[model samples]
Target: MNTLTTIERRAMQAISTDSGRMLIVAADQRNGMKAAIKDAPNGSDAISREELAEAKADLVRHLANHAPAILLDPEVALPAIVDDGVLSRGTALVVGLDASGFETVDGLKHTRFVPGVTPRTARELGGDAAKMLWYTRPDRQGLDSRVAGEIRDLVAECEAEGLLLIVELLTYQLEGESDEDYAAAFPQLVADGAALAVACGAKVLKLQYPGSAEGVSAVTAAAQGVPWAVLSAGVDHETFIEQIRVAMAGGAAGAMAGRSLWKDSLSISADTREQLLTERALPRLRELAAVVDAR
Candidate 1:
């Protein structure tokens, strides 16, 4: 049997309940949240940084109660949420290490890390785990090697700091690829990405739903027994619930999801957003938690 380090155990326990399944709520979105808030009714085309930070904090204050772990952007929500005492005891905090933009290199998109917040820094900031989202395209030459090296370096940093490393792997279409084609190819892409993350030393995997039981099974197998969870990918609430079921049935430990749980808040007035989150979003999270426990 594989042995877990002390920090690894703590990190895993933070994300999981006594049942050992992780029902995590992710609000680490940056660009997408800005767009949603800007596009809301009577909303501005540009949302100030301060406004965005407050919005994210509000999300944490309301949603953190529903999950064992809350994934947050360190730059936007961490300090405020910590100061506000929003995170309940036993609720693990996972901080995002990647920055806001994607870098296009040779027609494929690559993620960039935020400056000065390495795994060690994240640990110093009281993060139970450090998360990074990596864009992958298995068909592209040399991209895999570059991503592997990046993961290796991050893994070493996390190990040195004794923090858990959660890698969220996503794939983008190659230039000229149609949206339909990309959607159809996503399952295989996720499978390949999961294998790569495991090989490169990811302690936990936050992955997009693979769209089918078989696809989820394949991706889980590729994880090589490492704990893996599904992301909501901004799907509708009901759809995301089904996704959690399928993923857990396929051997995923649980889910780390956002957008689907709270995106509706963006369409309403700010005054009413909290009401909607309570009425619509909170129940969805409870239902997903039930699914994870059931699995």
Candidate 2:
């Protein structure tokens, strides 16, 4: 898999130790607000309308310093960022490729933001890789022949660019679905030539880490031998921290995080936030990495 260890090391060494360990800075800034997925847990509760609105604004406000991977719009956006060269190594500058969501059942392939970037853009971005944000489901609910075909093409394009495509789990989450069906369908999804694409080639596979003591086991079992990271699915700050810890405890390679990085506690200090993210936020991540290394 294209783990980008060298890039990670370089980024970490360069980062301020005052910031502590690397808490992925996901920077993919999407278009306008999106509707919450049907089955979004505490959808009506966790984040109130006011809070969610601020989350979007916070995304814009923190553009300069945000970490992890920034999922960018596929349209004529990202110009300022492009000029700034945010794509340099030590960062995962991702492009969001939203399929047929919020409307048509048939998946459509189009670049909505980050205009100039296509699968071909990565090579020029000075990028180690780009994630395809692949989110598909069953025959109709998720993937079908049409969606499958589009994914195949994307894979080809990403592969040609030597990029890594991470299948996003949020799509299904929004659609009110579970990975059980998707995981069960993954073998078939790959068998359908969707796996043969260029982008998915040996990169990190991402999955949801259900919030449970045994949750990681389920995720690991689903991932099998493939390299994978567990996501917290935009949980609250405390829960988010616990989620990352649990994921690391379960042997996840790393985390594909969002929300938590942006969601601040009611009265948290910047110093406390840094410690939580780098230290307590990812205690298990360090432990897991050491485990992988020892092996």
Candidate 3:
């Protein structure tokens, strides 16, 4: 890992609260939102691209003011959200560079960058920083090298363009891996993944809960001074709140969350959606911010 550069430090400050914590609201989801909408009470498989854009716009319009920053995808929410004035001037933007889904090769997962989306493109989209989601399984044979190479290359690319990168690491259960066994290994996976990403020059991280307070401490230690925020992972709001509390108590930087903040607002009537975003989601964000602020 390397020390933060002046540009990187500025980008980090841009996304952080006045108190200097990352309390980011995320609406970068594409496939995840589509699935939630399809399963929602009023949703159908016939969902349109415009609907997804509007949904993302709604999230930014309603909640952007409360949070210091919002995470959006280059696919739907980028230039438009910045051009349309939906995002507050005070709110910093972090654009997602990874594609919506991954590919499976021999029971392992692989990630892809969105075509034409580089750090320069993200900057052109008015992004203060760029985030890429990378799935890692260092313990698996043949994966460690590939994963490390990709992360190191990405960090170099971002540095070349003077853009800050937030590396989001996710781990999945392998083929023939039992639920209990995977669960038992979750903490080490997250900790080792963080260490690997940082070793590859990742200066910041957005990661999943390591399943225990002790696990959270392990990740914090592995980060080697890089800031790491906790992602919601689509858990329920209450559960996510507790997780954030535990994570911050264990020295997490803060959070970059989605579903837990506004999943219920999807596929509903306009009025109902607005109400949920305002009454429920907004408060949830504030409460989460409060947790980080308290820390």
C-alpha lDDT values of all predictions: 0.81, 0.44, 0.87
lDDT of 3 at 261: 90
Candidate 2 residue spans exceeding 4 A from truth: 1-23, 31-71, 74-77, 85-92, 99-101, 106-117, 138-144, 171-202, 264-295
- TM per prediction: 0.92, 0.55, 0.95
How far is 143's C-alpha from truth in model 2 (Å)? 8.2
Q: How far does residue 245 in candidate 2 sit from its true spot (Å)?
A: 1.6
lDDT of 2 by residue, 9-81 (tens): 3433332122332234443532222332122255434544444334333343333133434444433234345
Distance from true location, Cα of 129 in model 1, Å? 0.8
- Residues 85-120, candidate 1: write the lDDT tens digits: 877766788889999889887787888898878887
Top lDDT model: 3
Q: Candidate 3 at 295: error in angstroms?
A: 1.3
Candidate 3 lDDT over 44-70, as tens digits, reads 556677777887887887876678999
